[model samples]
Target chain A: MNRTITVRPGLRDIPQGRLGMWLLIAGELVIFGAAVVSYLLMRIRYPEWGEQAQYTSTALGALNTFVLLTSSFFVVKAHKASLAKDSKNVVRFLSLTLLCGLIFLIVKGIEYSTEISHGFTLRSPGLVDSGQGVASLFWMYYYLMTGLHGLHVLAGMIAIFVVMLQVRKGKYFHRVELAGMYWHMVDLIWIFLFPLLYILK
Target chain B: MNIAHHEMSFWRRYIFSTDHKVIGFQYLITGLIMAAIGGYLAYVFRYNLAFPAESIPLFGSLGPKEYNAFITSHGAIMIFWVAMPLLLAALGNLLIPTMIGTDDMAFPTLNMLSYWFFFLSAIVLLLSFFVPSGPFDGGWTLYPPLSADAYINTEPDIWKSFMTGGTLIILALALEFVSMLMGGINFLVTTINKRAKGMTLLKMPIVVWFINFAVIDFMFSVGPIIAGAFMLLLDRVAGTGFFDAYRGGDPVLFQHMFWFFGHPEVYVLLFPSLGVIAEVISTFSRKALFGYKFIIKASLIAIVLSVVVWAHHQFIAGIDPRMATFFSIGTILISIPFAGIMLSYIATLWGGNIQLKVPMMWALGFIAIFLVGGLTGLYLGSDTFDIYVHDTSFVVAHFHYTLFPITFFGFFAAFYYWFPKFTGRMYNTVLAKIHFWFTFIFFQGFAFPIFFLGLDGQHRRINDYSAFDSLMSSWHISFRQFATISAIILILSQFIFLFNLLKSLRSGKKSEENPWKANTLEWQTTSPPPHGNFVKYPQVYRDPYDYGNPDMKEDYLPQNKVI
Candidate 1:
């Protein structure tokens, strides 16, 4: 089959893929923003929530934030490499990004287990039994915000892995930038989540 | 470049097709089916309302639980499954590409995926009815504490949480939102990236403009609800008191989040319907849309105001009086822009060779009926007045008047106007006219009397109004019975439309390409445009509604015509 590649410029200078990704990022930001806003409202409403916030290990959160920020940097490197037609560096940088995402998840897993084992679970059955159920609301927001951000990290990893595979074959190099943008969004959300959940108190 | 059109398997071409038109039809057909189900739910509830305990034909005796579930499902199905899919998904998919003179959506596969996700959501909604808890009786708004706490205690098993009707309904809604978000992204990208060479932003048809605006609004507004729904879900299943007041959650927060999206969602549905009305009115009236740029500006103002006016819905939900006043003012002020748009439509119809075509009839009907809907909204918008009639049948009547005209009236207008383009055939006009009259008359018969019932202080969502002595007056009973009968006829009259559709598809007159002689690019192409929409890609030269130009020999000019 023969087809003509119509060279009509898009209405704007931005590539369609990038524009679409930007719109998706904007949507994702609002979802996270609303959740964060809800958390803030409740936090302000109940000052005692800060007492429960003392249980969160800020060290683990800082470590995970560093992991995510590094992953975002790796993704940017991969995007730059793709633009330079350096397929090998693109694949290498993307692997590093994926590894960072995995580390972030693993750290998140450890945090969850530690919290849960200490009876700071989502339902906070132990706290509820002690008539401290209201304090458990802090844990609920923590888990929700972090859990949602973790899922985005996982999604970003899968996306990067797919783009990495294609980059190795030197196919669809432009997708590297799209995947990078999404990864940055994942990192950006974590940046917001880290402070909102762990650092605020 | 020319590529050979390869023959595709029926499954590939029709079922899982990536073509925007085929996907549009998928959404349209699915939406129509959901509308039927929603209408059936309405029938059962209306019957229950009118005849109280009487067992109706083909349906069993109605319990209070069943009545609540039916009303909830009817509202959910009508708004989410019927209106959103029909107006936003179907129309956007069908018209955005064709109107902009593009071959297909920017991302065809993503478009297909959006439809399938919507299909999945519809399935989940249907499945909710079969769930043991009986399909979420807490109202479409799903106010928490009631919605959150009811079913969690009944089922202790963690997996059983997924099967409860409330959770399922929430899941369905979340899935539906995801589907629309994907579809919205595709629409925004396609309109911005894929317009034909000369199709500037303002040069596109009003419907395309409205659709993109609606999609943008949906994208911005839907996020809060997605977050809210997730929290509500956790409240139900995980025992995380995000909305459970006893567990330190604020139920009122959920209300705020829901209405924040909910109010904008009203305009999200209305904008597309308004766009359809604009096209139908202009085409039949043989005029350029009056105050085209002004209408766009007014709609933009309305969209901005819609976001701020959501608190009005929660005026009686224990909101501060000062905030209520602010919201009430915002709500009332928002109507001015809409009124401007309405006046523009009316002015377009003035002193033109108005052809009262079937689509034009629906457009005129929409303006007349929706005016009542809009004007009545002002009364409800006032905090003082709403305090008296909050959640009464009056609010119900007002919204029905608004939504029915926007969803069904606007739908029929676009459906009839584009029937020739969709099927390459002419529907039997006499049959369509009869269908319209039956629908119009019975619709007014059904909704108009309910306004009086509401004024007489009949509250909505009551299983048995007879138990309340004040509500059982002769006036109330008569109007209730009249509305029920009219509703029954109104639903049955839709059969005429379905029959006309089927009959026209089978043996209607083969249509010329531009049956309506409209100036849009869609009509410039073949009747039921072939693969890629156009034989030769169109170069749009003028504004979409280039009608009634006295200098033009034909009295109208197609957008592609260079003359």
Candidate 2:
């Protein structure tokens, strides 16, 4: 890629698209940071929230973490393939990454259904009725944090699928790295979500 | 400059155009229209407050609910819909590329999308007023308990909740924040990546630097509030307990989250207005900006201090005393940096060929009026003093003094400053000056009396003062009547500005390329620059404010001139 050096010397070495992506990542991180910080503050106030953590299915959380980690590796490989101008390998690794996103979402869907069927929904009826009203807040935060993460996974899958299609047509290879970077952010957020929600108990 | 261009249809060129200037104009007009709506809302509420149940001329009698909704919408619309769109989005889109000597924004399509998103959010907010329930009446801050109590005792249904005013307003705000985030990214990237050959960072205009800081401040501060808004919406719709104290949630947590974004949000508005004042002061004074670098550094320090002073707004909202003390000190400390910046502006005006143009008049009005607002703020910033005067009309007067000048005064200064470039025609200076004086005098007449009334222990957000016999003294009644009359005249005076704008667009004299003979890169281009902006791309040599240089033949030097 040909790069035109602008008068600002410091950022000229960074591609404009990559720089834009990094700034966007910074914004998204702060957003998630708010949720994380709020949760940690509330968790300290109510240690019994760890009791609600027992219901989060640690085994499934671990499996999804592995799946997301593998997807991150696949996206990095796709970035490498795009650097080499190998569109075929780029498509291959991107599709693998998309597949992992799909598996992670499926696992999350199953866990959500199991929790709901077991009367552990966002507005859990049993907790509210038992006069431990604050405990229901734990379930609310649990669903909110994981549910927001699940939406990101779905968005990442769509993004990866689009990039894969464009790569298949031998166009816009640089978007592969942008898509990879976004996927890493998604993966990184889940890494935080996992220990906080599932393993803390 | 030699690039060939093709003609496009009207829809592509104006409505869906990716050009920054056209998009800027779109935001400008939209914001002005929203300002009209907000102003009308203010008139209705002010009329009710003064007359106490007397029917208004244009609108009928105002009820308590209607009065609450009007004040709430007026505050929300002015800040979110008017000030932000006009100052940050409109001015940022217009000036960043032009002043930096670039053809367009780095991401033009995203820039276009940002305006459309803002347009959509404006529509949503307007539609919110006509919902079954009136618009959100829990104040512009959207404090919980009041905001979250929409359907407290009933079973929550998604569709039912969606139609309510509170939920719709939150949705509108979320959309607005998304739009601004997109616009912020575009501003940051464009200013960083696209500049002329010799236009280094320091050589860029102060307005561009201030816009960048405002955008950065916005991006960092708005996140927690976005998260908080989501939680508040869930509390309304999904039977969730994110901010309901009765349902295991703490409302104070919402206050912390809201003010976390709210206080910096003031700077997000102030910084750009200050930037406009800097440009206007330097130009009209025919002097180089005094302490230009110092002003920028001081504003940076002020931005940092702004983030830590959010809790000052919450001293009487049940925060810890120690935390309030820390916040009070922080809030008082913040005034120093701002004072330094203001002093620099005054210093820039010291001993030079000062021209009292319409724009310069507005700029001077801003510094004088905003000082009153800023100094009054220190009293409220202290925890001890705030406990007595919290939620009084004094706070109301303080903010209106600050915000009215920042938004409207700053806007008129910018609008008149760039009118020629915007339309390629000179405005009627006599009518413009008349408009400015009417606005300035009446604004002070309207907002200044409230300080005395608030000192007399008159509370805000009360529709009818008849219920409180103590608040309805002859002295209080006269002040209300005087302020309301002044506000009415203040709202009506805007028509003169509109008339001036219309007259200029139709039959005014053609403006020269550099009417002011100033030294910004934007003036180096034609009045109403062409599609590619410049016949030849400019190469900058010096800083934006090089007025009255000793070695120069002319009093001012343009940035692009190769001296």
Give the number of the best model, judged by DockQ: 2
Give a tens-digit lDDT track for model 2, residues B178-246: 899999999999888888888888898899999999999999999899889888888888878888675
Model 2: share of real contacts kept = 0.58
lDDT of 2 by residue, A73-176 (tens): 99999999999989999999999998899899899999999999888887787888888778889988998888888888888889889989999999999999
Q: On residues B1-563, what C-alpha lDDT tens digit does candidate 1 reach at each position? A: 12544577788889999999999999999999999999999999899888986897779899999899999999999999999999999999999999999899988999999999999999998999898888999899999888887335533456787888889999999999999999999999999989888889999899999998899889999889999999988877776788867668888999999999999999999999999999999999898999999999999999889888899999999988899999999999998999899999999988788999999999999999999999999889999999988899999999999999999999999999998997899999999999999999999999999999888888988989867999998888889989999999999999999999999999999999998889999998888988799878899889988887879788789999987
Candidate 2 regions off by >4 Å? A1-9, B1-6, B150-154
Looking at model 2, give its docking quality level: medium
True contacts kept of each: 0.70, 0.58
Q: Model 2 misses residue B502 by how many Å?
A: 1.3
Clashes of each: 0, 0
Q: TM-score of the candidate numbered 2?
A: 0.98
